[model samples]
Target: MTELTIVANIHAKPDQTGLVKTELLKLIPVTRKEPGCLRYDLHLDNDDPAHFMFYETWESRGLWQDHINAPHLADYKAATEGAIAEFTLSEMSLIG
Candidate 1:
């Protein structure tokens, strides 16, 4: 099966950029160890520190769903509540 790709765009509140970044970065280490996780990378926009993105690849959509239901992910969401101004997630399929 083809890899399951996801792009998550995150925007932090003006004053909470640093905290948002911190929380997002913390997920990298743990997420990379999860089953079926092929890649989990976090990126920051050079022009806008408040803007962040995650590029991820999973073995399958079901595995990706498992990642979403993880306790750490839920904790991250709860911890970053109100700090994130916007979040957009795109599930992508390789075209080529």
Candidate 2:
């Protein structure tokens, strides 16, 4: 099976950018330790202070599903509830 990739974009409420980023960053270390996580990286938009994105790779779709339901992810969602203005997630398969 090929690895599963995810590109997630997050746009935070103007005033909550810093707080949202703090919560997002906390997920990195924990997510990296999960069973099927191949890569989990966070990036902040250079020109847009309130924009952030995550680039992730997983060993399989099943493992990625497990990750979505993980406790840490729930915590992150709860913590940033209304602080985020927009959130988009794209699932992709590598071409080569």
Best by lDDT: 2
Model 2 regions more than 4 Å off: none
lDDT of 2 by residue, 1-96 (tens): 789999999999999999999999999999999999999999999999999999999999999999999999999999999999999999999998
Q: Worst ten-residue run, lDDT, model 2?
A: 1-10
lDDT (10s digit) by residue, model 1, range 18-41: 899889988999999999999999
Cα-based lDDT for every prediction: 0.95, 0.97
RMSD of each: 0.7, 0.6
| Quality of model 1 by C-alpha lDDT | 0.95
TM, every model: 0.97, 0.98
lDDT of 2: 0.97
Residue 72, candidate 2: how far off, in angstroms?
0.5
Lowest summed lDDT across 10 adjacent residues in model 1 is found at 17-26
